[model samples]
Target: MKYQDSLEQASEKAAQVKVFLQRAGLAAHPVNYAVCYDYISGHHAALCTAIEHKLSAKTPFDDFIMADLYSRYLTPANPQQEQLLQDASGIVSRLTGYTDLAAEQVADYLQQLDFSLLQLQQQQQNGENILSAVEQLRQQTQEFRSGQYQLQQQLEQANQQSHQLRHELEQLKLQRQLDPLTGLYNRSAMQHQLELWFTEQPGRRVAAIAIDLDHFSRFNQDYGSAIGDVILSKVARKISSYVQSSGLPVRAGGEEFLILLPDVDLRSASEIAEQVRRGVEKLRFVSARSKKALPKVTISLGVSLYQHSENWYQFLARTTDVLTLAKQRGRNQVASETMLALPA
Candidate 1:
């Protein structure tokens, strides 16, 4: 009878251990079977001791074994089995001084974990958005730099073209103002200069000297107009050279010249006119038709100074009057209104 009772008790313990292992999600196979068997044996010993104490009307041994189990593993239980053991401890400690509820604490702890997970998700999303914005900004900056570089290159090219065009325009202007035959100031250029000078303030002295080649029509008749043109060119060259070495000269008309002297009195202009007259009297040119030496070329000069009351047209007329007087007098001498008015 004793052996049969022991077998029955071992079978009951094995069945309870199997149920516990199933609930705990532990294997009850050959690998963990020894541990399960040992636990069941200990539980059976405690239960037998409790039954004996109950029969004797004494302190229950089952309570003592339960207190020991709680002390060993319930207070700070295994992390994987904490929820299961905590639930069981609430039921068992109901008859004891254990009013602290583990279920509510577990619920609160799970709520905190959920809130933390939400915050982590939001932070990750914000980081991704910031990275996208930075990439867009980098692309825009690169495009702006490319546009700026192209604009700078275009501006430099435009500036270079503008400079070259301005230089060409200046050269063209110089060519227009120069006489091709004698390299002197042309009639249009001299008129422009005269207009510019006359527009200034009053009492600024200005003199005009008119020069005519002596008997130029007869000379052109003797030789052809071609040789006459050569003589005229040589005469222009000589007059231009003399004026550049002395004063300013302009090719005012055919075989007629004008000199403008700024800041000069009538007496000084007359002296310069006389100098040009003597200079031309010394010049000689060869005739193109006969290939023979020609006589010396002579010029008649007329000089007049601007008055405060005179306009540009009137001043030019007075110089023409003086040239007519010089031509009527001899045709190879310098004459001025002031010189002609003096007593002989």
Candidate 2:
């Protein structure tokens, strides 16, 4: 219930969020997505002010800065958890105080009893009373120790429950960063990974391949969205299969996808892209009811190496331009930045 937007309004905002992320070259990671969504909503004045300040200063958006902004502004403090911890601490403090007081009382009583024992040896009248007091003190000490043990167990359980709650929250946040239909990392996640890769290895060689399903919109229009979704999922899986463990595959909205290859050259990335194109082209979908083969699918790809001087968005834009050139020349082909530089 955190979001109150109707279906139409939410869809509109989601589209805008994509555009915003694309423009800023930010990942659609949960933190970045939340920040973008809230900013577009125009509801959080302080958040808006902070973002505007960064923009005015022309500060580039990085994962660390985005995470800081999210932690500072968007992340809601768990009041219940805070109160529980405080209450537990208070209990521990009080228990310590009581234990100290009990120890002092026991010490004083033991001292008095020892004196009384000497007196009892002389008087032999109140010996029974002193023994009875000692017995009571021993019983009280045992009961207090038992109570402390129980309280310690309860505190541990509460800590465990709090940890579980936090883990669940983290899992839920991660889910939001995935493309629901394609089951691939969304645009935000792609951005986040790009940032991390560059941060981990400064000036690392990276190749980006931008992919678009050829004539997908036309196919979607001819067939229903449900069928189109099936194709999209299959294509996503095909693209992901080629990436394996060496690269990141992302569903960059609509019928577009991206593959980011670190430690891979442009030529190697192009070969992989070509393989994906062939793989997707080879996949054959059959109509469930009619038992007829569906239309053949193909993809256009653009490959580029990350330039040291360029930001991720600029790199993506240039790659996309190459992809655009492929589409313009003809669909279902591979294009590279070198080709893009050539005279038309």
Candidate 3:
């Protein structure tokens, strides 16, 4: 349904999609087919860009990865969430109107009370009229105080509702931004963190370390996906352990992960990358069913500095290219921008 290609265009793209699926050893299932079709058609800029990076790096695509891509980019928003969002917007608007109206009413009441006070001062010699005016003034003041107290109570209630709404929204946002398997940040969260860092301090240096588990697809094939998932989760935790609170650790689909370090230089990032690589290499896993030791898991990492001139995707792409270089030189190694400048 997402595709709107003409018959001829669809045919051409389908052919290309076939070739891509064949190359990746992925079956032409609906999810995989749609993802490849989207890529070939050049629609869905984000999906295209992601596929391009993977292709450039010769990363293997599997059923899980294909499904992930579709879910992340092509899947429709939850209807319930959409309805909730609309309701929240309406509530906020009404709250704003109520607050504005309360403020105006209070101001008008204060102005009337001031006029009454002035009249009382000027009519002081008219004792009976002054007394009557005083009584009127006292009643008006009491009404104003009571109204003010009521509005304050309403405002407090509104604030509480607003707080609760925000908390719920924050929880929802956190869920959306996290990878379900690894419990790490997802690409959307990563992009947002990058944007926030730049927005807060323009031209601030951000170091990116792109990491990929070497031969992870083969591992999944050998050990089965369930085991692969466990490995992924553990490795994610190990990677996250090294990143400070200032950094963001992300699961960038499949076996790929990215660490973003704001205000960090290339040297420090590379060191962190090396530490992550070594830590993953040191990890040992055993099959739950067989009690046999599994193959050692290792990671290849690429470190790069973000350039102010380029978008986050471009910066990530360059870092991914460096990761490809690490893969080329040998897996379980580190590559950097300096290496990017050198010959392959």
Each candidate's clash count: 0, 2, 0
- Cα lDDT tens digits, model 1, 1-344, are 21243777878877886885575444454323434454456544544454355446642222112323333322333353454445445434542322233344445545655665565567677774445444544565565566556655655665565566556556656655666666677655666676777677456788889888888878888776787778778777777665643356776545778888888888988888888788778887775657789877889889999887866656766787788789888889888977657643
Model 3 root mean square deviation, Cα atoms = 6.2
Model 3 regions more than 4 Å off: 1-13, 16-75, 78-84, 100-144, 196-205, 262-267, 289-292, 306-311, 337-344
Return the TM-score for candidate 1, rounded to 2 decimals: 0.58
**C-alpha TM-score for every candidate:** 0.58, 0.67, 0.69
lDDT of each: 0.65, 0.81, 0.86
Candidate 2 lDDT (Cα, 0 to 1):
0.81
The collision pairs in model 2 are 27-188, 28-188
89-144 per-residue lDDT for model 2 (tens digits): 76567667656766766676577667655655654564354565556557766766
Better of 1 and 3 by lDDT: 3
**Which 10-residue window of candidate 1 scores lowest in summed lDDT?**
59-68
Each prediction's RMSD over C-alphas, in Å, is 58.4, 7.7, 6.2
lDDT of 2 at 338: 88
Candidate 2 regions off by >4 Å?
1-133
Question: How well does candidate 1 match the true structure, expressed as C-alpha RMSD?
Answer: 58.4
Candidate 1 off by > 4 Å? 1-129, 244-247, 287-290, 339-344
